[model samples]
Target: MKRRVLIGLFGFNLLRQSSAHHQQHCLSFLPNPIKHCTSIRQSLPQGAMPNNVDARTMFSHIIKASKLRIISILMDNPCAEVIVVPVLSDNYAYILVDPDSKESLCVDPAEPRIVLEAAAERNVRLSAAFCTHKHHDHSGGNMELQRLLPGVEVYGSCYESVPGVTKGLSDGEIVKFGNLEIRCVKAACHTVGHMLYYVTNPGNPELQPILFTGDTVFIAGCGRFFEGSADMMVDIMRMLRGYRKDTLVYCGHEYTLRNLEFAKTVDPSDSVMSKLSWTERVLSMNMPTVPSTLEEVCTFVSSPTNSTLRFLISFQEFQYNPFMRAGDLKDAVNATSEVEAMAMLRSMKNRF
Candidate 1:
């Protein structure tokens, strides 16, 4: 009876491949890793699509993220069991939980009413608020929620006031709550001290690790450069790649469709084309596309094969791909030594 919704904003691309074209669309539905999430994983044979190794592998992994194991909590199924509440403009607030314990955490709350209503409906306690950064859209409801629910621990970056932030943490600090363990990562580019929260339940390691990557990282996209430099963001992304491949990524906004459109201009090809098509389908359904895995994200954004995609990809692009641990990619991003990534980001921002 728990209701949930997932939202995603993919990279932007203007080229619309004919919908009628019979190119094998990788359409395996990953189960909703939220309360209303319902998905089944299907694996298509490899090497099926020419010019799209990254898309094929990435989508395949995404379907895997949707596959549920044994449901030990609220519902009798294994899938994403949470709620997506829309907040300021394009942002979304999420309620993540461990069904069996009835313990839950709120991610980037923008409005208290939506969270309070969801909590009341389930008769569950809101023990923690995991914030991605200090932006208002992501943390506007923090203070309100704290006022409404006494004792809910608010977690965020050490650099800014995250509304209800009860704990000021640094990178690599791990906190335990209920059956979950969250690793705090310093994702400083979006905000000088922005942080991404990665959560995992020790009791169910099979469940993918979930990352609340606020404005720093997005589905098929990344946040606009603000406080930190491009190299800083790149280093942070490399650190994220250290986690398991199946980690689930829950970001702050719904800009995936538009992000993908922009990516096409940078790298116009079949890989971007197919992925954009898939993004359109998700948007069409009006479903949230968060809770994506690290592996899938890396495949789409970090793989060297999509060099053209790199031009359109901002230095913040590193925020989305944690698998670039080698640091070699950072060099590529910094190749144009004379020109600062932040300066380039500023130029792009002016255009917008």
Candidate 2:
């Protein structure tokens, strides 16, 4: 009895989890979605083999099956797609797959059993697990996942310890995942080791840049400064504000509606109103509103001076997130600096 192995080489390269509680989970498996990417993937590729192929004969059929159906699959779809796995109530962890090479990685595998099962179903290997912070919901499954996925690289911040961080990263450091270039940013507000991973694919312009803000920044809101001060958060916002305008933000928690409500309580700008309406629509469909563009987050809707250009340019120079635009906020108008304004704003949010 022999096995036949078929390896499909799509263009050049080929291919690329964990488990947790039995909560209400949703699997969003996007396969090189043109609408989605126009964002990220992580790993190399391995094609699916024929059903009749036996274990021993599988290796023998590799070269023969190299030009099979995967070619058409890859040819039709050349960009990467993210598999959004909802874990632990409203928390989200992502799996980005590189189309050329099936190399993939998971972000915040809260439950190794659940995460690994999802990845196995997709035929993608877990090359790495990236932990944004040391929180139980985010990095609690690190050691377990490491045990499940032997030789897998687990990355975290160098400042504070993450649960099972094999690699301690610093700010401005670059990590390469196949074609994706990930830049580590140490945002030490939520937790001392709290970090953000920003990804950019220069090879594929079709995908937009991605920023994984783990409890540091959320859609229409920023996180409460637990370990750090308002000044520290202001600094983080100052640095992140400089990212590419089109960068898509994927945050840790699904707190958009609540954050939007808080935003209205503070500013109630046109952008906040529009964002409120949009968030409701997305939530109605039970979709995750994780990825908002950096441009949208940074630019708040302000009254336009030019009536004709109002439609084209509706955003003000201030940020949509009240904490991000503390200086421009009516609540914080009396504050001296952005740092002071941020402090005043967070104090208000803490009470609210």
Candidate 3:
């Protein structure tokens, strides 16, 4: 009798598995495009997707047909949302999704496996990848991801050697994916040919604009002057000021703690600087320090007065006293000969 009972239970589970598999296959037929730009639904108008979607929708039909019983027994909570994976020790590669149509968009992918695993877990179809800049950490994963998902659109400012660049994006060009319309803004201060993507979904205006600044800007600090000038950065800041104060700014790198510390040394009296100490500590714990605001940029580091040119000691006016104003510093630097500037920078760095 015990043997018979065991056989019956095993047979029951097999039947349940078959039923679940069939249900999942039926869900696939309900319109889930293998790529993001292609809408799965037949009836909806163009471009309707979210920046993120709960994972349940990926396998909802199967869980429903099984009445959530067998799945609950086999897996963790059925209502648990998908986990957004972090990669490269700092970069957050995300799959922006539209569940109704099963369309998806990939943003700044830094690792192929991390993104592939998440998409496989949710059965999400990846559409295109929007690259913010040419920095390797930001664009390196595109080649491998494209191999896994063929014909995926890689959109960004024209890079001479970037792989999978089906569309060469330029400043002010707007690209659409589901409900999101992303405007590519030329924000090239960190690199010679960098751009930022300003993402907004009209359906939810309250969500605010999402600015992918790449290495051009950071939370408390901005990118180092690599291939661009302070004048160019100031111009970019002026253009960025057009966005609302609450726009969410996502930048490349995880350098908030270090940046805030550096900012404090520059502008100690600023209230924004005083308040960001806690922000630094939070980031030090290996958390994301981005999605900051444009208001914070003005308050913290994004103004003409804080121009990187002024920060470059060789370019700054040498002041006899610590309390000397930036104007005085600028004058002093301008007054110095090239030899004097070099000597001053060496001495200051040694002291600094």
Best-performing candidate as measured by TM-score? 2
For model 1, the superposed segments whose C-alpha errors exceed 4 Å read 1-80, 296-352
Relative to the true structure, candidate 1 reaches a TM of: 0.66
Q: Report clashes for each candidate as comma-separated counts.
A: 30, 41, 10
lDDT of 2 by residue, 1-352 (tens): 2112223321221222223633445455423312222111111122132233222220100111232222111111113446666777788888777655678999998877677767776578889988999889999989999899999999999888788999999988999899888889889888877889988766766445777887898887788787999889988888877886657678888998998788898888887877777677557645566567666332211122322211222121234678778767744447878788888888878887
Residue 278's lDDT within candidate 2 is 65
Q: Give stretches of model 3 more than 4 Å off.
A: 1-85, 98-102, 204-206, 273-275, 284-286, 296-352
Residue 1 CA displacement from its true place in model 2, Å: 47
lDDT at residue 226 of model 3 (Cα atoms): 71
Candidate 1 weakest ten by summed lDDT: 68-77
TM-score of each: 0.66, 0.73, 0.59
Task: State how far residue 242 of model 3 sits from its true place (Å).
Answer: 1.0
The lDDT ranking, best first, is 2, 1, 3
Which regions of candidate 2 fall more than 4 Å away from where they truly are?
A: 1-23, 30-80, 204-207, 296-319, 330-333
Q: Residue 212 deviation, candidate 2, in Å? A: 0.6
Greater-lDDT candidate between 1 and 2: 2
Q: What digit string (tens of lDDT, one per residue) describes model 3 on residues 163-240?
A: 556788877888876766788887665676687877776655544466777777666555655776555655665566
Give lDDT tens digits, candidate 1, residues 67-146.
22111101112223455555556787777766456687888877766666655554567888888778788777788888
The alpha-carbon deviation from the true structure for residue 323 of candidate 1, after best TM-score superposition, in angstroms, is: 12
